[model samples]
Target: MTRTATSAHPLDVALELEPVGDGTVTGRTTAAYANMVGPFGGITAATMLSAALRHPERLGDPVSLTVNFAGPVADGPFTIDARPTRTNNSTQHWTIEMTQDGVVATTATAVFALRRDSWTSTEVAPPAAPGAESVEPTPGPEFIRWMSNYDMRFVDGGLTDIDGERGDSTTTLWIRDNPARALDFPGLTAMCDSFYPRVFLRRGQMCPAGTVSLTIYFHVDADTLSEQGDDAVLATARAQHFGRSYFDQSAELWGRGGALLATSHQVMYFKV
Candidate 1:
């Protein structure tokens, strides 16, 4: 099967991966993924992880995953290399690194669970779900420019400026898997890294200062693309902290009827 790259929004284009000899590969990204932090913000460590894991032969089965952001990223084609840490009948461990313009930009390590094994169940109730039609999507080319990977639709109060005097430090968004290509766990994780700012906009903050790290948890894998055809993926984010030059952020994902889907957290660096 041919692997297709997935985007978080329309402007977020997934650059095709090419071989660079050895155990390395290169991929390009559209400027939309750069965020307001110039051509180097929000490009995330997981983005590199996605590129590294794009090869499914390394993953035993899709399950739970965690990524640690080691550093910053820049615009243009990036390179990634994956090394297997361990592989068992039920799980796989990996160490991945991302390079931009021949410079090491970020590194990550992850644990991916497999589906073909017996395991104990340890599921917990997710956080509260927000109103489906109350939270809205950001509008205009400036905001829209940041979201070019996935297809998005407004459900509430967006399309205005995020100049700090808006609503609260919280907002919800409905995001779907980009149908332009076939997506997998890493792709979804990469997209998860892209969903934010609804909480920041309420504080009238523009441009990301910097992120110390980003983490995501997958409660259920969104394997089938069509599964989300009729269901809307709700993403709710909160600004944990806004300090002199950095911010702590976290977000949760829910299904149409409020099922806990996934959760994400990150430390971001601003442009101020």
Candidate 2:
């Protein structure tokens, strides 16, 4: 499914395309979504649950997802919705929504896994942050480009600098996604995942692999686009757990000025 911009400033969802369901979607709360001081935050859980609701079919997919917390999510009224945007013989796509106070807080499109049997492997070094000289921020119009909400500067020496040192498992960078985009919450949420891979390299290990899966949870429906001015957001992330072939990363979201905004997490499977 394609993404669009919406009016909601914080918990926004962009439904540029027509919404297929009139009322098939609703919002709910889990312990994780409850507002309490703990590892998991409600805003992130709510955002994630809302995203999952976008594609009910995924509930049946073999893929499993877990969302960790960087901070606490606000408690408020939130909305969730989804619709099929495209379908073909081989695969299907859908969009997700998280809304509150008549605004789209977060929106995302998920492509369901379809070809489990079709398998192939190739040699590839994991995508790593380029050296300080090479990792300059490429700002542009593409969604992947650094939007106006942030001012991201690679930490000196690169994430690999901490190799095997105490606190080496952590990766820090400069980020500021702020000012608030007036109507593009989903697009803002999408960017949250874009920088996730950087945290994995904090260990400074050679991760000559790819993300088998990725999931992002929004912690306050506070997805700002260009309208919010030049506000900034910072992300501090670390690997929470890892196995021989898989691992998870947790992140904290901070407004550019240093106020805590939200928390997030992702589960990754290294390509074997």
Candidate 3:
């Protein structure tokens, strides 16, 4: 169902898109999701996926996606072109580009597949954390507007005083929409990018940093997501290596009953 910007939550409004024909959709950036430089990266990625999910020929649920932030997105209107480049008996591939004023700002690719009931097993373990109720919610920094949209209670590696607190770069938290919306693919996609950049924890100070590329794989279907209702999802992330200009982060989201929802990895670049 298409969410009407007029009556839905701010997230729905930020994600709302208008059909402009030929697989293109136009949307505006709202302050609700604004970042220091532009709209938050997670919402940008979610919007791209939403376009393909709404496509007339979209085959099934999104199984995988890769979003590349090519340039900064200014605060205003943007256009996204989501094209299903290929489709098979059970899978479809899509290419999406978000442009502002005819200039490419972000690009993405998505894969959707018809899932079947088959033998499955989870090799990774869920994030070990006390119940969400046991942990105290951390207040988002006032300057970062987008952080206010999520209710986050940290188990460890929470956003710390940037600078001189060099320690482990792993973050475990329970997070959900501030207004408690049902968990879905778009929300799940956005959540995958919700972890603050690991570099901040490593150096103990914020810098000019941003995600360059993010890739996510969804492990559950619609029924499983619906079961989550508006409950917070357990999330954990850790960095592998930090180089001169970039670092790698791997993360996972777990639903109730210790069910894994998705796994994601991102490459972030930073400058001193």
Q: What is the C-alpha lDDT of each candidate?
A: 0.57, 0.42, 0.90
TM-score of each: 0.71, 0.42, 0.96
User: Candidate 2 vs candidate 3: which has greater TM-score?
Assistant: 3
Residue 214's lDDT within candidate 3 is 95
Residue 17 Cα positional deviation in candidate 2, in Å, after optimal superposition: 2.7
Worst 10 residues of 2 by lDDT: 32-41
lDDT value, residue 181 of candidate 1: 38
**lDDT order of candidates, top first:** 3, 1, 2
Winning candidate number (TM-score) = 3
Worst 10 residues of 1 by lDDT: 1-10
Instruction: Give the per-residue lDDT of model 1 (tens digit) for 81-161.
Output: 876778877677777777776677777767666554346453644344455445443443554455664545544324353
Please provide, for model 2 over 63-129, each residue's C-alpha lDDT reduced to its tens digit, 9 standing for 90 to 100. 2223333222234444556555666665555565555565654554554434444443423222233
Query: What is the TM-score (0 to 1) of candidate 1?
Result: 0.71
Q: Any idea what lDDT model 2 has?
A: 0.42
Which runs in model 2 stand beyond 4 Å of their true positions? 1-15, 20-151, 156-167, 176-184, 196-228
Best by lDDT: 3
